[model samples]
Target: YSGSFLYAIIDWSFGQKCNRHRIRTWNAEQRLICDLLDNYQVRWGRPVRNTSEGVEVRFGLQLIHISDLDEKNQVLITNQWQIYEWEDEALKWNPAHYDNLKDIRLPIKRIWQPDVTLYNYADTRLEEKRDVLAIVYHNGTVLWKPMSIFKSTCQIDIRRFPYDRQNCSMKFGTWTYDQSKVDLKFYRDIEKFDLNSYVKSNEWSIIGNRASRFTEKYDCCPEVYVDLKFFISLERRGGFYNYILILPCVLLSCLTCILFWLPPESPSKLVLGMNIFTSFFVLLLLLYKNMPSNAEHIPRIGAYYCLNMGMIATSTFLCTIVVHIYFRGSGPMPVVFRKVFLEWLATLFFMVPHTNTPEHHESYSLIPPNKAVCGGDKFEKFELLKERFKSLGDKHLRTTNNDPNDENIELTIEHECGQSIEDPLS
Candidate 1:
């Protein structure tokens, strides 16, 4: 018990001494912050200990969101944060001298950053995050993150169209410096995209991604240059196209098929065909608006619409010919037409040749134009039928004594085809 009491007293004394030391360090840190601005150098140059060896800037990208992808212009817009880390000997300091201050946030202009820029940029403005701050650690390790929106060029292939997937590449490299002066490395040795903070797009989704780094020597310079290429595969969200475009296209195709089933002699059949054709043309125009006109391969959907349109046009022309043949009494029916349409097609369609015979027909005016359409010899039969109708009307007036209300004396026309036209006045 005596030994334990003595140990407790020693521990209390050490704790009080440590508390006083911490208070002294706190004052030192506050005093150091007052001189932080004065020590910061805005015009600092690139820090390299050996002039021959380059300062290696390890960098990576954190993709936040894909705003839009324009197929016509072949441009992709994205929002991302650029992560860069490198050691600067000129920016180093002793942390113990300033109360173990580990890091400080300073305007990026006070230090040197790698001139890494998007190589495949479509938009000219690449350096948009200039006024950002970098976190400077006491050991001279600087960590900088600058957020920027990039518009990069991508080769667009829309042969699959609404269901298509695209692969876009973003290449980052130092613009003016060679590999010897400004070597690039992946931040933290990680190669893939940092999509931990990704916001998904409504029209497209990221399916896959690839990252690679390589150095190349070009003809313009003898020295080699380093670049990091990141590729993202995007797949279209087809639900919108299916409902807005594909569904309507399919329904129009079905209607085009039905146009052939409409009666050949009906004028409305041609009108309906024209309507379908117009609707299909409108859909084609809408599709062209979204796709590039200079595509190499024709899309499957485009070919389908074109073929359907041709079918619609053919149906319209056939309907017009059939209508004209039914009304034209002078032109003799062609033998091929009589054999194919009147005989073969009629049998195939389950139609009887003289199905409109007067025995089954009601009125004298129920003219089966099919016979006249078949041969002009039936004109005399029609003329005789008209004379008989003229005589029947006069005979009916004499029998009824002009009494329309007399039900006993019914007015009727007895045609040569053995059919009667009964009057409603009876």
Candidate 2:
């Protein structure tokens, strides 16, 4: 039953108004509400005349904002609006009866709505119908739009890391009903989603997206289940990482180039190499700590760090060897070693001879005033590098030993100019 005396007054006033909006007085709206709910045939369960002909629920989603995507937990949390539209002939009415009332909003609880849910939900809260309004049109059509925060499980592949792209899917299907009871499909009339309403995410960007309808039969149940899957291709926003992570890693890796330029015997070479290696280790540790522990594939940035760390370790080891050999007392340089390394390699590297003080020139010099040391020299006297060392041993020993004319000298000592002969390590 509708309202009494007040309904009569409102019904009379509604007939006097010609305005489209004013046509629906309190009486008109209340009469429609009473006619729809007061019917004993209307029930709360499924609003359909026959169970054999299933009601098709045209459902879609509008992504408003990306709240967060947790890599470790492999969950994608999104803020979205759910859209559903279906026909219920049981709720249809004539617009002429209610002063051309085409549409009316009623409590969503008073109607039958699909129990669509994310099958792989990650949140603790269960999916439930919200207390809102569903628009009921005179043509036996209903439209329900509700905002929801969905935490759906998504597989996260971090193999590419900062440059990686991820494909995350949100699977929506009926929680209990089978395809025979409730069929799901995309709405062709409405724009799939509002692109203008989407807020730009700080860490991820949508590159590609697809919506699909999947129908499958479970092993335990004879009936097939229908679902709509929305796959979103998200590319990580690398601008922040480019500066904070990639740039620093590249700069630290470039520091390894300095090791080759340093002197072979200098201790700083090994020290610098070790320092760069330590930096790489620290970076790797930080990346590992932040990443999912169960990740199967290694990240590109991690591999890059490992490659440089290996180089630094190898170079540091070689540097240690070179410094060790430089300080070792290996008697005199071998004839072949001296010819290849001291003369050929040194000249090829643009190495210049170490200048000696005027006092020590006499000790190492052989045919000093005018000498041809190599093939293209114009000096008149030709003397090889070996002759200079022989002369230093035979000539300087006698001079330093204070023997002017020692004919039967049994020993010879060789040394560089101005260096102390007493300390061997120095």
Candidate 3:
């Protein structure tokens, strides 16, 4: 055999003590046999393929080799495909027909990556397929299958499946098929750890049963999925607090605004204004007490109420000013003060952007007459009485003229032409 290489199909078996490789070739071919016996060593306690009664399952391949059984570098298979091949026959390849053979590579399956999210709980490994939560197996392997389940648990009671009913229906059954199922009897000794329930122990109680089911034939993994209800409660925390605080504040502020409708003529309007101011102050105090003091900005509810009170207070102050100027003097108020108090204030309230309150009204009162306007008429009446008094005095001094009608008398009390008395008419 010149320029020929001989290749043999090697079946390396260990249980029956066999050695078939020759150490020396006459043509000086030295095959290196570096402890070849160790490669096929078999332990007495190791499981072997055999056939018996109850031991048949125990002896026959309970676990298939995931790939080529290289314990140091293990690989898992997910898709079915060819994994072995022999060399193809061609005219130039006759001398080394069996020397090189082609090995088929299959798609790897069930490869797990360590999930850091579950590090605080029991050790967990996740296997994902097509971006879905396929399996979260316990972090170990016995023989070839994952040893996710203990040997004691039975009757798994899943509180919630990984998928909702709609998705579950689309996928499989009442329970979502995305998660792996393991034997229930293998989980009796273990307890599941919940991160949220554990941290919030004072608020929530720990719940749900932790069990196992057959993911494939012998693999079992943890199934973790929470419903939408759990997440919704977490998202509404701020909204709930805001609603509780703002509802009452809005109602009271509206009531305070209504005080502006009280008639300016009524005595009660002043009391109502004072009362509203007190109530506003009290509410402001309450807000400070209940809310966090570190917030430099005001709460939304407080801002709204403050704005309402401001408009109402401005309206009340203007009414009081109008009443004061009306009664303070006998005539109309000075034009400057009237313009400042009426026109400008009216613009501030009625013409401003926030003048949309439903029941606000403009108030005006009339000024009283001045005493100087009627002074001359009062003086003329006084002068007529004085003339009667003087005539009575002269009656005692001289004989009175017996004339009931003195129209013919030429006598008159006359002063010099240039002289004048203060005319009563004036």
TM-score of each: 0.73, 0.72, 0.27
Tens digit of lDDT per residue, candidate 2, span 1-426? 456677567545533424445435557877786667545244456777776888899998889899898888888988888888999876799999988998888766556778888887898895434655889999989998888888988888998898889888888899888998899988763424445579999999999877888998888899999988888889998898787678889789667666655544457767888888888898898788757889888898999999999977876666566555445542454576556655665566554444333234353354442231211122221233334445556554645554432211111112121011111122
Model 3 segments more than 4 A misplaced: 1-233, 236-247, 337-426
Flag the better candidate by TM-score, 1 or 2.
1
lDDT by residue for model 3 (155-266), tens: 1111121110101000001132222211111111222221321233222122332322223311353553211110001111234334444555666666665565443423
What is the TM-score of candidate 1?
0.73
Q: Give the candidate number with the greatest TM-score.
A: 1
Let me know the TM-score candidate 2 reaches against the reference structure: 0.72
27-47: candidate 1 lDDT, tens digit per residue = 654445434544444434668
| lDDT: the better of candidates 1 and 3 | 1
lDDT of 3 at 251: 65
The lDDT per prediction is 0.70, 0.69, 0.28
On the 0 to 100 scale, the lDDT of residue 385 in model 3 is: 29
